[model samples]
Target: MSRYREIKYRTVTSFQRRIGNPILKRLPNQTLLETTGRKSGLPRKTPVGGRRIGNAFWLVSEYGEKSQYVRNIQAHPQVRVRIKGRWHAGTAHPMPQDDARARLKTLPRLNSAAVRAVGTNLLTVRVDLTN
Candidate 1:
C-alpha cells in the first residue's frame, strides 16, 4: 500500500471503530452483519448498509479483507444478518474479484457515496439468506 492509502485506511478505520460503529449498531432499524469472532468465538454484530434482493443480501466492505468482520467471515462463513429489525441466517461470501464500484451503484446511495469516498480496498460481499 502507498503511504497515502495506508494513512487514509488507518484514519478512517480508527474513526469508524471508536465512534461511527458503536452509534450505528444501536439504531433499531440499522442493518447489521453478525459474524462469529474468529478468536473469541463470540457473535460480533456490525452495522452495515446493504440491500436485499430475492434470497440474497449484498454489501460492500470498505476495507476489504482488512475489516475485522470480513476476517471473521473468512474464518467462518456461517452468519446472520439483521435487516430492518429482523434477523436472517445466511452464509457470507467475500468477493474480491467483483467490481465493487459497480456493486456500490446498486446499493443505497448515501452509503455507496461514503464507501467510495473513504474506501481503500473495496470488496463486495454477498450473503445467501436461507430464510
Candidate 2:
C-alpha cells in the first residue's frame, strides 16, 4: 500500500477505535458494513455507499478488488451491516462480471489527478448484500 493509503487506514482505524464509529458519519444513501476476519475472527468495519435494488442492497467497492476488506468479504460472506444506525447480519455476494460492470457505470470515476498525487489505483469493487 502507498504511504498515503497506509496513513489513511491507520487514521481511520484509530478513529473507529476511539469513537467506536467511522468518521464519515452520514454517507447519504450509504451503509456501515462490519466484517469478521476469516482467520482471526476480529471485527472490521467500513462505510460504503449502496443502493437498494429490489430486495437486495447493492454496494460498489470504491477502493478496488485488492483491498484487504474486499478480500475479507470474499473469504467469508457473512457480514454485519449498519444502515441508518440499524444493524443487520447478512451475507455478501460479489456481483457477477456483467452486473459489476453495469453497476460500475453508475459510479463516479476516480479522480485521476488525486490518484496520481497519491500514487495508488483508485478503483472500486461492486458487491451485493443478501440478508
Candidate 3:
C-alpha cells in the first residue's frame, strides 16, 4: 500500500476503535464486518459503510481494490457483519457492473474533500447474509 493509503487505514482503524459500535448503529448505512486474518487466522473487525441493494448489503472498497480487507474477502467470503448491534453471518460476492452503477446512483453523495482524502472507488460487492 502507498503511504497515503496506509495512513488513511490507520486513521480509520483508530477512529473506530475509539468510538465503538453505538455510532455505527446510528448511521443507517454502516456495518461492522468481522473476518478471519488470512495469515494469523485470528478474528479481525472493521467498520464499513454499506448500502442495501436488492436482498444483499453492498460495500465499496474505499481504499482501492488492493485493500487487505478486499483480498481477505476474496480468499474467504464467509464473514460476520454487525449492524445496529445485530450480527449476521454472510458471504461476500463481487457486484456486477450494472448493479454497481445502479447502487452508485442511489448512494449518498460525499463532498469532494472527503472523497479525495479517502480515495474510495465506486466498485461495490454484495454481502449475502444468513438470516
Candidate 4:
C-alpha cells in the first residue's frame, strides 16, 4: 500500500477503535456484527450499517481483511448479527471477488456514502441468517 493509504487506514481505524466503536456499539438500535475474537476466545461486537435482505444481511468492510471483525470472521465463520435490536445467528463470508462499490449502492445511504468516502480496501461480507 502507498504511504498515504497506510496512514489513512491507521488514522481512521484508530479513531473507530478508540471512540466511534465504543459509542456506536452501545446504541440500542445500532446494527451490530458479533464475531468471536480470533485470539481472545471472546465475543466482539462492532457497530455496522447494512440492510437485511431475505435470510441474509449484507455489509461492506471498509478495511477488508485488515479490520479486526473481518479477521475474527476468518477465524470463526459462525457469527451473530443484531439487527433492529434482535440477534440472528449466521455464517460470515467475506467476498473478495464481489464488487463492494456496487454492493454499497444497495445498502443504507448514509453508510454507503461514508464507506465510499473513507474506505481504502473495500470488501463485501454476507451473513446468511439461520434464525
Best by TM-score: 4
Candidate order by TM-score, decreasing, is: 4, 1, 3, 2
**Ten contiguous residues with the weakest lDDT in model 1:** 9-18
- For residues 15-123, what per-residue lDDT tens digits would candidate 2 score against the true structure? 5456734455455434677778878889887766565555455665534554566778888888877766777767776653534444644543442333234323334
State the displacement of the C-alpha of residue 101, model 4, in Å, after optimal TM-score superposition: 0.3
* Candidate 1 TM-score, C-alpha based: 0.97
Question: In terms of TM-score, which candidate is stronger, 1 or 3?
Answer: 1
Q: How close is candidate 4 to the true structure, as a TM-score?
A: 0.98
Per-model TM-score, in order, reads 0.97, 0.58, 0.65, 0.98
| Residue 31 C-alpha lDDT in model 1 | 97
Q: Residue-wise lDDT of candidate 1 within 9-127, one digit each (tens)?
A: 99998998899999999999999999999999999999899999999999999999999999999999999999999999999999888999999999999999999999988999999
Candidates' C-alpha lDDT: 0.96, 0.58, 0.65, 0.96
Global lDDT for candidate 4? 0.96
Better of 3 and 4 by lDDT: 4
> Which regions of candidate 1 deviate over 4 angstroms?
none
Error of 2 at 126 (Å): 6.9
Clashes of 3: 0
Clashing pairs in 3: none
